[model samples]
Target: MRIYLPATVTELGDPDGLVARVVHAVTPALRAALPDEDEEGLEFAAQLLAADDSLDLLGERPDAPLRRVVVAADVPQEAVAPLADDDAAPSAVRLLTAVPWSDVACAHVDEVAAAEDVTAALAGDEDAADRLADRDLLWFDVGELARLAAGHE
Candidate 1:
């Protein structure tokens, strides 16, 4: 199954390392919640949810750059389970084990120009957060992750 993992630039230090457990994927609940959306739409919705969660990750690593990162990867279906938290997003899930970097397919990340809004959003600015939600993240191949983490385009 494919999943979207919330992350930060600095967290990509090792392109072949393990990622956190939390991820977002199209679950049955997400399908039920957005019954009218096509598969592509649902997937995009999950990615957006992951992007929002990325903000929380950024808050945890103050030394990390202020940019949202969503790692899209293909993992075994058995590797993930729906999150137990009732308050979690419809697409939220928990990985039963660590996800290896090799499983990652690509990444969607905020461009450098989005850093200002990302900074304010992390500081609890609602408008800044809204602006971030409206922005489109740039796509990067799995091979570019190391360079991205190094603060290069």
Candidate 2:
């Protein structure tokens, strides 16, 4: 199963993929939420949820750099299971095991150019936060995640 894992840049290639993330799918709930939504919309919604999960992770780990990170990983379908009921959201699932680096297809992270803005947003600047939200995550090939995790600038 292809899943989106929220993460920090430093954790990009780590074997442990458990973090504040929601492994999402086109569940009946999601369909009900947007009856007209197509496959592309559902995928985008999952990505957005992954981004939101990254924010939750940042909140829990204040020492982490201020940036959004989401890893697109492919694991065995059997390795995943549906999450329990949550009226707030029903499209989420859980990964029952750790995700090795080899399963990662790519990573989406804040661009170096947006780091300053992200920092400012993290400091509680509403305008900066809004602007930073407008910025999109930059995609990096999975092979590059190791380099990034190795303290590359």
lDDT on C-alpha atoms for all candidate structures: 0.90, 0.73
The digit string of per-residue lDDT tens for model 2 on 30-120 reads 7788788898887667776777677667767777777788888887878767777675355677767777777778888887777677666
By TM-score, how accurate is candidate 2?
0.80
Which parts of model 2 are misplaced by more than 4 Å? 13-22, 85-88, 116-129
Query: Residue 21: error of model 2 in Å?
Result: 6.0
lDDT of 1: 0.90
Candidate 1 lDDT, tens digit per residue, 1-153? 999999889878764555557899999999999999999999999999999999998888889888999999999999998788999999999978777778889999999999999999988999999999999999999889989888777
Poorest stretch of ten by lDDT in candidate 1:
12-21
Clashing pairs in 1: none
Which portions of model 1 show Cα errors greater than 4 Å?
Answer: none
